[model samples]
Target chain A: MAADKDNGDQEMSGLLKSNFGRRDFLRTSAAAGAVALAAPARIGFAQGGPTINMQTWSAAVDTVQSHVNAFTEATGIPVNYGNAPWAQYRESMVTKFVGGAPLDMMWVSDAWLPEWAEAGWISPVDEFDFLMAYNAEAEDFCTNSMTYNGRQYGLTYYTDFMAFLYDESKIKEAGFDAPPATWEEVVEQSLVMKEKGISDYPMMLAMAQESWLIEFMSALVFSHGGRFVDDDGMAVMQEKDKGAVEALQWVVDAVNTHGIVSPACVETGELSGLKAFASGNHAFAMVAKYRLRMLNDPEQSQIAGNVKQAMMPKGPNGDHNTVGWMRFHGMASQAAQDKARAESTAKLIEWFGGKANGAYTFQKFLFLDIGAGFGVKPLFDDPEIRAAYDAYGNVDMIQAQQALAMKKDVVTPWFGEWNETNGSAWQSAILGNTDAATAVMKSAEFWDELKQDY
Target chain B: MRRLFGYEERSAAIFLAPVLAVLMGVAVFPILYSFYLSFFRIKLTRPNRTPFVGLDNYLDLFTNDLFWVSVARTVTFSVVSVAAILAISLLVSLLLNQNFRGRRVLSTILLVPWAIPYVANALMWKWIYDSGYGALNGILYQLDFIDKYMVWLGDQDKTIFLIANAFVWKEVPLATILLLVSLKAIPSDLYQAARVDGAGVWQRFIHVTLPAMKPGFMLVLIYETMMAIRHFDLFFILTEGGPGNASHVLSWHIYVETFRNLSFGSGAAMSYVLALVTFALSYTFIRSLGRKV
Candidate 1:
């Protein structure tokens, strides 16, 4: 009886699945239209006058709100500004885009440019000569990052690059007059620091598979003269001479052989790594250069006076290269369709990303409020911005490294798909589950497959 | 109105229309549409290019190595989590079943873990598992269990289990409540009869209590199995399917495919596969442990 009942149940489930027809599907699709009402209630629509709906990740909230208030007073164009937590921001924006929410403008990452552009979710800004004028004064890579295909998509919000940082006190205590200049020197110094009992893990890396993983990996790859994808968008990370293997192998040896890098590095994310580095526990780290502001602030860091930036170490065939990334103010494609809305959003984008009242007001203030790097070349000579950087950072080294910084080669429409696989493959190599070559090869293969799909 | 159809039926149809419409709109439609979408290549980014692909999505998943690995990880996580929750809940419920001082207070205290939000619980555990100054390290260090602080969640071998520990902590309270109700519903005469038959504490528990907790066990098992199989938030918060894909379970795979890769078709197919497995397990538990239909 029990056997008969189980068989009957299985049959029922099978029958249910098999019985679904095209008519039922059509009926369901029609019924599902009601779910559109369940979507989060949108803000007021701009019927009387143009209102720019802006979405940003919650960072510098007070600063952004004050700026929005000022813009409204100055332009008389009301703005609906909403923000989500930084970690979940992209997911939320993707949902809004897919659901046809009333989005006028949003912050777009360089990594998302290709995908967003291809999807028609965002519109290009090539026609806006007012916005385009800033491109000449902007850093070349920053402008390039904002452009997808042959058209410019937006104006730069901010740009920053990875920097190699070390605790100067620990380095001095370990009897090093200068920081390492190359990958080999890093391993040597790390081993010496480990043997001296100065630190347990002399080199700290946030290799945990998260959003920041690609940035960290890219910096290493670029400095080592390797590209995950070449200028022509073909995978070359698997090539032995391309410097990917050399960089990855060095890390593997540091963890398993030299014991300089903690095995737990695989699980450590950038946030945790920052805290650990600030706790005066490590001699070397690779982090965002903007973090220098926090590191040198006595209130936030234990090693406040000791933290210092260094040139990114070179590989055998590479130079002191690093990865640069930027976020920009973008117009929604739907909004851009309305010429009046387009003009208003373009003006708003210019207000924040370029200048306000004929001066780099937003850029100047943003740099002062947060140590976020600006793309405008003129702001580099600003007294307020200069003083802030000189307080905590070396302007010369920042400029030199920024010059060397390259946009990530792997940013394509298929980037999001390829990233997880690449991160995992690199991690597997670090864990000794696969050889470095095999991992690199597998990543390249996956990249090729994704590239094919696109 | 009675002449239109029948006296009672006409009135009933009129009254139920609103509720039935709502049910069709919200619940039935989504499931059917998702099923429909699973048969097509619906890339959300290229919203215009969704074409019918028949069984291609399912075939692709079945052949993919990552999908297989995710399946193994999902099975491992669900089995471990459900077993741990069941064992802990049973023990707690049995102890609570006894007449003891502050029983009510203890029961209320047991619900605290369950009361915490999923995001908050994951964040709390994240801090606890920090290799630097986390509570786990602090306590372990204080006890001289280890000479130095050791990585907890970051460690690949321990990532899934550590996540499971957090999951079990929250889940045990609800399971305990269910089992406690079963213990309460038992007649006092059952215990008296067992005593009359010279059954000792252990024997009576074996023959009477354990056997009687079947319905509760079925409920707990089915519920937890489904929860564990589809659990995403903790993995998302903790490892993010990281440390060399050590904790990349099926649910995370589905999310990455749908949300990250924008491959709604394959993601929907994977979700259906997970649903089928969950349903099969629930059915087996009900058949073995539930009261006869």
Candidate 2:
């Protein structure tokens, strides 16, 4: 036995000498050691049951994990929840999908759904019988937004719409009795606030290079009675009837000509505007309804009780229109390829969006927790849900109505590209790099080129 | 075990296998695959519909005004950033090479910015450059530098420079360390001889130190130029190539085309174009610098 141990020790030493040779090897070994040390601890799960994996942004992870845990507890199926930041979520999803990783479900933005659905990355929700019941409870716009090529591939889990969130005290300080109802009133009231020093910038517009800016612009275009695309699904921002150029010009004029908005508006993102307004520094901000949660949070907001929500201001054309940005829970096509996994994923979807179980109630409560509008119709009419927003004075109801009323624009597969191109032009115009009409016309040509590729 | 090849050859092959595998998997395969994909009309959103469209994608990119604009911006960014990095790093290296008290401690601490992750460094600088409630504006305001806070990122002309400043700050430490190592390697005897020969301080530096540090200086310049040309994270996090494409670099545009637009063909073609430009420029620089060295 001692001889055998000696032989083993000799072999180990020989192996080390062969593999790790001197200074260069030591450096490489040190790097490998550091990498190993930096690696996260491996999490172990029980061995027997089918496991479901869900990917989403980190912001939704906790809420998603809670739901996952409840589903696992009731069904005895293990679940793996993966999350990345909003910036990395799309890349992660695409990598996982292409790599053939077993992803059961994922939360995708509405803008990304068409692309994923068209690519066959996600399965159609119509294959499951539970969707009929689910669709019955969901709002038409929400359900319609998830449908592509006559097939539903996802269910709207959280709904948001653009609304005018304002600091009531600031507006009152500017001698306004009510929130602005027209573009003219908005400019006038913003000037008043600026003049009175109630806010350095009276309005916070999301002009950052992000989807939020595009969404805001879409609302602006819609409010001006403009369609983002023509009936042939071609970009028509250059068309005179659409008012797209006019919508962009108004935003530019607000920043450069009127100077009601500070140059800082060019840096404001969706959340940044909300946070700025919540700091009691702005009279008004055009932001999503979900920001109400942060603005209402006593710990997170200074203007919690002093803020009010109103419908988006009308445009020069007197059009009271806006757009809805929806997020949905989609099942992976790979998961649907297998019978058992498909059934399990469908059940998970039902538990998240279907009205049969208390899952829908829990989902509504979760949306309410974040001050987001739910896609289901009954939740809006729920007295308890309605009463929860008493502090904000019926903003929840207002958002719900707006979500229903807003036009669902740019739902096609090319929406993402179009939005990005349009956003760049608008940003240029806002920054005075180019005129609004010139920017829109140039962007329109780019959009037309992008359309050909699709 | 019995070796199939000679002992030295076998050992060398065994030792290199892992690294070669890693290189092939991570670098070589992706490059070849990207080149292949560039010839096809591929969209990530239409995976099954990819069709062969050789040269069209490249033609489209060359013709596109936005692509050319981004290339120009990238060149401007690289030139300015590389110059700034070289000057600052050379100055720091010179200062740190002196035999002063706490020289070692200062040298160690100087790597803090380099040690921080690029994304984290970018986020910190974003806060510093923030138009509202940023340290830069706050400091300026407190000093009565301006009546109101200036939005540093809002202005088109300043956005690229501001991001370039952040990039230089994060990059200077590595360049400094590289140049400092070269500086330290210069023989004290050379400086002693220079002084004895009646050379002034500036003359001694020019005669004795500069020539000795040429190799390291060239290395840092090449490395930093490459880094600046292919810079992605700093632009992505700080400006996102924006305030209206004012700071849009080639890499950022490539990323937007590839990932955001899901036009993999166009993105890959642009990336190859960028790669060719970088390769040509780097080769030219190295050849010229090699002659000098």
Candidate 3:
């Protein structure tokens, strides 16, 4: 009976296979249909199309989408567009990389390239045409931003620098003509503001999360002539570099001794940082250029015209430093599942980055539409763009100050991961959970742990 | 007729096959694969290069102090949290079993914390523990219960306590659910018989309820212990295992090794070690109960 049953089952299986069309034709057809949907993408790219994904909430969203339409009409390459929430963008990209999902191109923060490249998560561009097309003014692009493993990883998408944002009216109310130019002067003027009770919170630092902390403190450390991390992957802080420790101590003193920053500042993250500054609760914040937009927005900000941007205070080392940071949008090398798609995507990237598309994208879409107002090299000198920015004379002066002074922090080969690892520890120190020395030591420990794995 | 020990041959095979296959597929295969991976240098970072390294990762991890420290931390957190969950859940289940008004409502309320997403729960608790504008400090200050703001989540030394508190709050409800189900399963006749024999509430609980709920208790213990080991989201959200690694647990350490450090070999090795440790703890629990499925 068992032998007969086994023979019967085998015969039935063979019969079923024979009845199925053309050796799994249905499955093949389904896959082919999906590919057919993707065929138009090739057609678009062949005509010099560029597809882009941007953060949904960013000011640049509408601008980028419209510019994509224009670029497609001009170049005949269809632009594919997608959007991501700012909060989830970083984690979403990581998921795509891990899952090998179909994301041919995307945007990433400048700091992410090193770790991404090290993990072989992105493709290196060596083509001269692509480079020339992507960033024609390559030298003007922040040198430290794009260089990874001594190779150009991507083109600079936009530029932004942090400046000291103060209430110009508040300063004037405190009988000052302008913002303070030195830490001592800030303390003195803040004390004056405190006595007059004009500003409840004289100064505020976004000491909550490490991302802002690193940006704010790097500028401080660099002004004092300290290297954050050395080439061998050792944190220079471990060596008790005079500049780093001094800068850290100054921050600690600013919190504990001066009592200028709110105690709650320790628990505040980036959004909260922006909120505190915009609410007129704080007199000064080391903030990026885009904050002015929020301050000017009537729906979101309470203190509009009162806000003014100023150069960051000069350190005792007789030097002032600033850090300009921004996100970079590009195509992912790992995005291509096969050769044809990869070729088409690469060509699209080249086209989008080239002069005909690049200038339009930056001018019409990114800067104007997004209200990002970030200046790219080619469009930096555009009269209208300059006029829009120069309308606020104080902000214009601060932008000029930053351009002359700030350096993009070295994107260390492993710096992206370092940010993830040590960024929080830096916050802890400022929050009074740990002292400056222990904080640096703990940061060093994290660095060392990462180094071993590297 | 061939004297087959009277077992229903077809029924027996059908019952065993599913469980046997599941045990092999989900449990056995992964364990074996992890063990194999532990011996080699597999990089989660560089997925393309999975070259084998004989015991180098293991040796490196063994020598690494951070790994050992995290292991110690994980063990401590697991033991403390598991024991607290068991004790609290048992007590709560006993209270709920009493005939009382609003018992069901209270039980439903207990389920709310478990229903909450881990990230949301973390944020809620983070606010409660916030130093400056948090509910705890705010109320304390308003009521003049304390003089100066105390940073509950801010202190490194106190972070483990905060994390444990969150874990206990979340897991006790689940443990209570299991224990309550087990309690309900015990026959009322057993308790009535114990009462007739002049048994008190404590005595009945000791003799009848405890013995009857052994399987359920063991299951809850095993599940909670595994969860305590594997769960990194809450810690990642609340502490980022920081204030200088004071709160860094094994899972978080493994995450840093794999994702942040991008050392696939070391990350794989650490993760395998973590899995092994979790397995050993679970196996010990199962063996001590004198049970297998």
The deviation in Å at residue A153 for candidate 2 is: 3.1
**Distance from true position, residue A271, model 3, in Å?**
1.8
Colliding pairs, model 3: A49-A77, A59-A370, A60-A370, A63-A365, B43-B264, B44-B264
The CA lDDT at A289 in model 3 is 70
Model 2 chain A lDDT-worst window of ten: A40-49
lDDT of 1 by residue, B1-293 (tens): 65768978878999999999999999999999999999999887776788999999989988899999999999999999999999999999999999999999999999999999999999999889988779999999999999988978767788899999999998999999999999999898999999999999999999999888888888898999999999999998888897899999999999999888878898999999989988898888887666541
Model 3 docking tier (incorrect/acceptable/medium/high): incorrect
Query: First chain TM-score in every candidate?
Result: 0.88, 0.84, 0.80
lDDT of each: 0.89, 0.80, 0.69
Once fitted onto the true fold, the runs of candidate 1 whose alpha carbons sit more than 4 angstroms away are A1-51, A68-80, A338-340, B1-12, B291-293
Model 3 superposed RMSD (Cα)? 7.9
Which candidate has the top score in lDDT?
A: 1
Worst 10 residues of 3 chain A by lDDT: A49-58
Evaluate residue B235 in candidate 2 and report its C-alpha lDDT on the 0 to 100 scale.
86
Chain A of model 3 scored by TM-score: 0.80
